[model samples]
Target: MELTAALRGQTIQNRVREVGINPNHWYPVAWAHQLPPGRVIPVVVWQQSIAVYRDTAGQVHAIEDACPHKGVELHLGEVHGDRLVCPYHGWEFDRSGQCVHIPYFPPDQKLPCATALSYPAQERYGIIWVFPGDPQLADSRPILEVPEYDDHNCLMIPITGVFNAHFSICNENTMDVFHGFLHKDLQGWFDPVLLNLQDSNSSVQANYRVSYKGTLSKFLGLSTNSDGVTTRNVSVHYQYPHYHSTMEGVSSLYLMRLPVGPNQTRSFSLLFLPKVRLPKWLLRAIKPVLVPLVLRFIFMPFLEQDVGMMESEQRTYQKDAKRRYVEVNPAIIALQRLILRQYEQFMQQSSQSNPANPASQPPFESWQDQSSNSSIEPLTVPHSGKGQ
Candidate 1:
């Protein structure tokens, strides 16, 4: 269904702030390079803690962070060959989360029916993605496509963002191009006007005509001269679990959000600039140094500013959920409505099915949890243990 693009002064539902994610898609969990071979890194998708490990062969795997036996955190364990070995009792679990070994058990003894929940895991575009929803749907959902990733003429800046706000807040920040005023001192953009807006069941696209001037503008390849202002179209597309926004191709950002819990969210993003295209071999050689420089000197400042504002919104929302709010941007209101509706849909499905052990779907509260899991016990291993 297509939604109309009309800005109005309308109040929105506060429940949007509490909405959950549709877990039926694969979400990027960790930086590909960060999880080295033979090492395990713990991550959380929704509230479920997962132990992501790479075997000696550099293959990535994600299993429920908690061990099936004794409820110890599987992340505290180590990766042996292709299996994860529980630190508590040396119980070994394969990539499928099946316990394949128990050192104390005699040979030929059937391993206890102990298996940690495993997610559908894959590696792409230098990141690890896991399906946090129905295992059956993993194969059908598609990951965001980026053709620029391999193109040499593009300068890619990989960025990591940690937000103390809900995913909805973070998402709103991305959709609202009018917030460029927040970066005025840095010469972000000015005179923003929504030129077009369209939405569908899977996406909300907002295009704005905005003027840019100053050093930041020049650095972003927005204008040939800093003293002159250039008007361009900034289109932001909220594609369900991830985002892809482009400023007339001068810069492109792909924001993959990971909803950690109610109060926090994380983003793994890749910013591609077509202006800096170089040869493939040469670009590969310089990417290590260039990627960080652009991220630190160029992108981080904007992200930091956005984070401050996002956190502020979250803090205030926490203080008063009933506070009346005013909204003018039709795109923003539509965005909020779509968010709330998705969650409501998920909740409706969950309520109608009432399946035994149903896992959460979205709207954050609809589906019941079907997986057998446990809570994380802080200090499960000795506090003085290695790497503590």
Candidate 2:
């Protein structure tokens, strides 16, 4: 559905900051290349601890991080052939997370049924994606497509990020183009104006027209030179847990989000700069070096500043959850609405479908209200081996 692109002060929804992920989509867990064959990589998606391992044939599988026997972390185990061997005992679990072997078991005794939770996992765009939702819906949904992946003119740079903020806050930071002021010293874009905005139950898309005039903008091919003023249209599209933004035709960014918990988030991003691509052979030869360098020098600075501000916002929010905040960006308001709506939908479905499942909605009454109290339990982040 279409939404008005006009910028106006809209009422803010504080609940968006208090909700959780729907867990019904393909979320990035780790970089595929980082998880080598015959190795285990533990990650989390919305608090679901998963141990991702690649088999001998280079196939990825995601299983419950905890062993069913003694609750040992499966990532501490080893990968042999297509099965993951539990370290505590010689139990072997297959790709389906089924315990198929016990080294000490008698030949006449049937293997005791043991199965760990498994998720539908796959690889694309040099990243590992896991479907944390219903396994039945795995094949029906697809990862966000990046057409530039096959284009030779684009130099694809895969970047990873860890943010000390809620996924909603991180997402809002992405939808907000007006924050360019924060990057002024770095020669970031300026004079931002929201060009268009649209939203739905599952997504929000926005476009902004901004002026660029600085070395950093020129380096990104956004302007002709650092001294000259160049106006460009930047479009940001958020298809729920993932993002695809483009700066005219110069470059594109695909940010896949890993919402580990309420306050911690990680991102697997691919930055494609069509302007940076050179001769095919030379580009291919130096890409290994060039990609990391550009990501470090050109991108990390902006991200560091953004992360600082995001963490600051989260800290403030934690202190006063009931604090009324003012926002001028209509796009941000729309994005917040979408975030809150998704959580509400998930809550609604979970209530109606899983009446008997007690562990559906988070335990709200027993815990102190974060909005009312300053302190709460630290967020749980399994994949990154960090606690929020």
Candidate 3:
């Protein structure tokens, strides 16, 4: 549904900082290239620990990280053909997580019914993804499509971000374009105005008009003149556990989030930029060297600043869980609502299916109170002539 693009004070939902992820979506665990054939690596989705391994046949599979027999971490084991052999006892498990062999067992003996839970796993866009929810829902949910993944003409740079914050906090940083004030020194966009807003049960989309001026802005095609301001529209779309944002034909970002735990988050992002005007062959030749240079110089600085802010926010939130703050961006409010809604929906479905499982209940009681508190001081927006 459409939401007004107005900037007005709203109480920041303290509960948003306490909510957990809806794991029904696919989450990136690692870059596919990082896990070679015959290697096993450990990963986590929400709190589900998984061991992902690539077999000699080059197929990827994921199973519970612990060995069923002795509770040893399976990642410490080695891959033998299509099976993962536990390093401690040589117990072998297949892709389906069933114990297929125990080397010391008699030739005709029956093996114990030892099985570790396995998850649906696959690869797309050079990333390994694992489904940590209902197995039946895996096939129905599709990974976010990126048309630019195959567009060789665009310069694509893969970036990894680790933030000491909740996924919701990391997400808010992406949706809150007004935070450009934090990046003003880096020639970031300013004078922001939310042009459009759309919110749904699973997604939030926001378009913002922002102005930029500086030599860096000119070189990035964000400004026509180095000294004059240039205005452009940026669209940010949050689809449950992932994000895709674009800057008016100049750049596109596909960010896949990994909620490792409540206090930690990781992102695998593919940033695509228009190729510099040059001969096709030369562009291709320099791309190897150019991608790293662009990442180290241009993108890292912006990310570093963002990381600092996000981590600081998390530290403060951790110190005082119930401290109330004020937010003016409708887009951020919409984003927070979507995050809470998705998690609640997941919990509801889980409760209906397994009513007796207390694990299906909401993680905390405080975030459930949506009503405003009268005792706390409302955060006051600073009147610094900057967009709030």
Candidate 4:
């Protein structure tokens, strides 16, 4: 549904910060290059720990991190041929997570009915993706597309962000373009006006008209002159588990969010910018050096500032879980609603599938019954003109 672009104060729900991920989507666990052939690495999606490894033949597989026998971490073990070997007692598990052999067992003896849970995994766009939810749903849900991954004319910089904050907080940072005030020293865009906003069962899209000036703006093709202001439209789209944002033809960002747990989140982002006015061949030849330079000198500074604010928000939220806050951006409210709704949907489906056990649903009491008479005192945005 389309939402009004007008900024209006709305009560913030603490439940948005308390909700968990749906886990029905594919999440990027690690960079594809991190696990070369014959190597294994440990990764976590939500709270589930997984061991991801590449077989000698170059196929990626993901299985429960714990060995079924003695409960040892499978990542500490080695890969033998296409199977993962348990460090303790040399138990061998195939890609299907079935225990096929025990080193000391007799050749004619039947193996125990031991099997570790395995997850659907694949490699794409230099990312190792794992499906942590219902395996049956894996085939239906496709990974987010990134056309720029194969575009040679764009200088693609892979950025890794480790934030000590909830996925919701990290996501809000991406959708809140007004926070550009935080990067003003870096010549980030300012004078923002929300142009469009849309929300769906699983996504939130927001567009803003923002102005920029200074040398950084000229270097990024945003302005013709260093001293002149340039206005551009920036669009941010949050499609459940991932994000894709773009600024006209200047840049594109595809962020794959990994919610490790309630208190931590990681992002695997591919930032693509138009290559400098140089030969494609020359750009390709110098990409090895150029990518890191841009990542360090240009991106990291901005990321560091974002991380600081995100972590601070988390820390403050932690101190007072029920502290009410006011949010002016309708886009942020839409995003929060989507987050809460997705989690509720996932839990409801899980409850239906296993009615006896019944997954616990989030307590959205205050959020569901929000009104002016609520007891929680709402904190308004500070008027100090400081970057919040």
Candidate 5:
């Protein structure tokens, strides 16, 4: 649905900071190259710990981190051919998590029926993805499409971000274009005005008109004249578990989020820039030097600043859960609503699937009652300036 792009004060929903992710979607765990054949690594989706391993055949498999027999972490085990061998008892499990062999078992006796819970796993776009929810939905729910992954013309730079904040806080930081002032010294965009906003049950898209100037702007092809200001539209799309944002036609960023827990979030992002027109051979030759230079000089500074702000916000929220804060961005408000809705929907589906399971009940149920009202009293900030 379409939303007004008015910057009006709205009471922030504190529950958004505590909500859990709807796990039906595919989540990125590790870089494809990081988990080579015969390597096992542990990854967490939301709060569910998973053990992902690549077999000798180069196929990836994801199983519950805990071994069913003794509850030892499966990631600590070894990979032997197509089976994952538990460290403690030497129990061997296949890709489907079925216990196929137990070294200590006698040849005459049949092996006991034991299996570790397994998840659907795949490798795409140089990243390893796992389906942490219902296996039935894995094929239907697709990973985010990245056309630039194989496009030789675009310079693809992979970035990793580990934030000490909730996924909601980290997500809002990306959707917020008005915070450009934080990176002003770094020649970031300025004078950001929300141009349009749209939201749905699982997505939020915000467009903003932002002005850029200085040498960094020229380097990014944002402006031909370094000293003169150039205005452009930045479109940010928050599609459930991931994000895709574009700076007109100059660049595109696909940020895939992994909600590790309530207090931590990880992002695997691929940034594509169209400024370089060099041949594939030359581009590949200079990629090693160029990737680090761009990351250090252009991206890391902005990410560091964002991380500081997000962590600070989380700390403040943790200190006083009921503390009220006012938000001026309507897009942020919409994002909060969408997040809540997705979590609630997931809870509802889970409850219906297993009605007897009390653990399936939604967390922060009181927030649903309070948020039903269209508006709440806005809290006033002391400074009322750019920093707020």
Candidate 6:
């Protein structure tokens, strides 16, 4: 549904900070290159530990991180052909997580019914993705698309972010363009006005007009006149587990979030800038130097500032979960509602599939009713004299 473009103060709910992710979607676990053939690494999605490894044949697989025999971490084990060998007892498991060999087993004896839960794993866009929910649904749910990944006209920069905050907090930081005030010293955009806002069961789309200035503005193709002030529209799309934001054809950012636990989140982002377009040969020559330089001198500073604020928010929220805060951005509210709804939907499905599982109950029943009212007003930033 469409939402109004008016900013208004509303009581913020603490329940958003406590919600868990709907594991039915695909999540990026690690860069494909980071996990070499015959290597194993441990990854967590929504608190579920997984051991991901690439077989010698170059196929990726994900299984429960713990060995079913002795509860040892599988990541510490070795990769033998297509199976992962547990270090503790030399128990070997195949890609399907079925125990195929035990060092001490007799030839005539049948193997025990031991198995580790296996997840659907795949490699795409230079990232390893895993589906932590029903394996049948993995084929239907699609990964986030990045059209600029293979485009020659766009310069792609891979950015990784580790934030010591809840995924909700980190996600809100992306939707809250009003926080540009925090980056004013870096000549970030100002005089923001929400132009459009839309919300659905699975996504939230927000568009805002913002003014830019300074050398950074010029480098990003955000300004044209010598007066150094240029206004552009910024659109942010939150498609549940991931985000895509663009600035009037100047730049595009696709942020893939990994929720490690309730207190930590990691992001795998690919930033594309049209201004940095260059011949493929020249781009390859300077990419090593250029990617780091832009990331360090340009993006990292803004990221550091955002990290500090997000972590601080997490700390305060932890200290007093009941503490109330006023929020003026309607986009933020829509994001929270989507998060809650996804979790509830997952819990409801889990209950329907297995009614006897007590764990399938929604974490907090109070929050279920919270998703009823989904209307939200748009965010509006106060105008500065220079921009107006």
Q: Pick the candidate with the highest lDDT.
A: 6
TM-score of each: 0.88, 0.90, 0.93, 0.93, 0.93, 0.94
lDDT per residue for candidate 1 within 172-261, as digits (tens), equals: 898998777787666677677787888887788888887777667666666544447788888899888799999885989899999999
| Cα lDDT listed for each candidate | 0.80, 0.81, 0.87, 0.87, 0.88, 0.88
lDDT of 4 by residue, 28-114 (tens): 999998999999999998889999999999999999999999899999999999999999889999998999999899999999999
Clash totals for all candidate models: 7, 1, 0, 0, 0, 0
Top TM-score hit: 6
| CA deviation > 4 Å runs, candidate 5 | 225-227, 277-281, 358-362, 366-388
Q: Give the residue spans of candidate 3 off by over 4 A.
A: 223-227, 358-362, 365-388
What lDDT, from 0 to 1, does candidate 5 have?
A: 0.88
lDDT of 5 at 377: 41
Model 2 clashing residue pairs (backbone)? 43-383
lDDT of 3 by residue, 349-381 (tens): 887788788443346452353433234343333
Better of 2 and 6 by lDDT: 6
Candidate 1 wrong stretches, greater than 4 Å: 224-227, 277-286, 351-354, 360-388
Give the worst 10-residue stretch by lDDT in candidate 1: 379-388
Better of 3 and 6 by TM-score: 6
lDDT of 5 at 352: 81
TM-score of 1: 0.88
Give the alpha carbon lDDT tens digit for every residue of 1-388 in model 6: 9986678766677799998899999999999889999999999998899999999999999999999988999999999999999999999999999999999989788999999999999998889999998899999999999998988667778989999999999999999988888888887788888888999999999999888888888777655677768989999999989999999979999999999889999999999997764667887788878889999999999999999999999999999999998777778988988998898888888888888873432386646433324355544456554442
Clashing pairs in 4: none
